[model samples]
Target: MTASRSSTRSPSVKVAEVSPSAASCLNVLILPLAIFNWYGGTWIRNELEVVVVVVVVVVVVVVVVVVVVVIIIVVMMIITIIIKNHNYAFIINRVPLYSA
Candidate 1:
C-alpha cells in the first residue's frame, strides 16, 4: 500500500500567494454582503436582527413541543384508567355517589 503525502503551507506563505490586488478584489466581493447593506444599516442592527429571529424561533418551537407532550400525557392517562377499570358505568356512579 502507498501512502499519500500532504504538504502544509505556512499562513504567511499562503497569504503572500494571494496577490494584494486579488485579495482586495476578494474583499470587495465579500465586504458588501458582510457589511449589511440590506437596508443600509450598522453591524449592531444586523447582529440584533439575527439574535431576535433565532430567539423567537426557539421559543415558538419549545412552546409547541411542550403543548404536544402535555396532550399526549393526558390522552395516555385517560386510556390507562379506562383499561384498568374496564367499567365506565362504575366510574360514573362512583363520582356522583361519593364525595371523597
Candidate 2:
C-alpha cells in the first residue's frame, strides 16, 4: 500500500514540475514575436509618412510652376496688344486727309 501511494504521488509531483517548465518555454517563444511585431509596425508607419510628405511637396511644386507660366503668357499678350494699337494710331496720323 505504501509503495502504491508513493508512486501515485511521485507522478503528480513530476507533472506539477513539468507544467511550469512548459509555460516558461512558451513565454520564451512568444516574447520575440511580440517585440518584432511592435517595432515592425512602427517602421512601416514611418515609411508611409515619408512617402506622403514627398508626394505633397511634388504636387505643390508642379502647381506653382504651372501658375507662373500662365501669368507670363498673359503678360506677353497684353504687351503685344498695346504695341499694335500704338503703331496703328501713329500710322493714321501720318496719312493726309483731302476734302472733296
Candidate 3:
C-alpha cells in the first residue's frame, strides 16, 4: 500500500502592521522604560546616597548646637565667679570709720 501526500500548503498569516504615528508613540513610551531599566540600580543607589548625606548633615548640626550650648554655659559660669571675687575684694578693702 502506497501512502498519499497532501499537495495543499498552509497560507502564511501576517501580523498587525503599525502606522507611523503609532510607531512614534511607541518610541516615545518605550524610551523612558528602556532608560529606567538600564539605570534602575543607579537610581536606587543615588537615593540611598542622598539619605546618608542628610543623616550626616543632621548629626553634624546637632553636634555643633551642643558644642555652642556648652560653650555658653562655661562662659556664664566664669563671669559669675569673676563678679563674686570682685565684690569680695571691694568689701575687704573698705576702711573702718572711727567716731570723731
Candidate 4:
C-alpha cells in the first residue's frame, strides 16, 4: 500500500488562511533563515562561551558563599540566644530569697 501525503496541509495553517501565496513564500524562505541561524549561532557561541562560563561560575560561587555566610550567622544567633538564656537562668537561680 503506497500512501502519498497531501501537498496542502490542514486548515491549521494560519498564514495560508490569511493569504494562500504567503504560506508558500514563507516555506521557500525557511532555508536561508535556517542557514543564517546556523552560521550566526556558531559565531555567537564561540565569542560568548568564555564569558558565559565565567558568569555562571561567579554566580554559583556567590550563591554558595552567601548560603554559607547565612548559615553561619543563623548558627551564631542561635548560640548567642542559648548562652544568654543559660546565663540568665543561672543568675536567677543563684539569687537569695528576701523576707517580705
List lDDT for all candidates, in order. 0.69, 0.69, 0.69, 0.66
For each candidate, give its TM-score against the true structure. 0.41, 0.43, 0.43, 0.43
* Residue 80 C-alpha lDDT in model 4: 97
How high is the lDDT of residue 24 in model 4? 68
**Candidate 2, clashing residue pairs?**
none
Residue-by-residue lDDT tens digits, candidate 1, 1-100 = 1233246554566443878997687566545456665657655456456556556766998999999999999999999998877967777776776565
Over 5-32, each residue of candidate 4 has an lDDT whose tens digit, in order, gives: 5665567876425376865664454444
| Model 2 Cα lDDT, one tens digit per residue, 1-100 | 9888766754435533458886686556555545766877434255455446556766998999999999999999999999977768777887879755
Off by more than 4 A, model 1: 1-45, 87-100
Per-residue lDDT over 11-93 for candidate 3, one digit per residue giving the tens place of the 0 to 100 score: 57465698999778756755554577687634435545545655676699899999999999999999999987776766666
Error of 1 at 41 (Å): 17
lDDT of 1: 0.69
Off by over 4 Å in 3: 1-45, 88-100
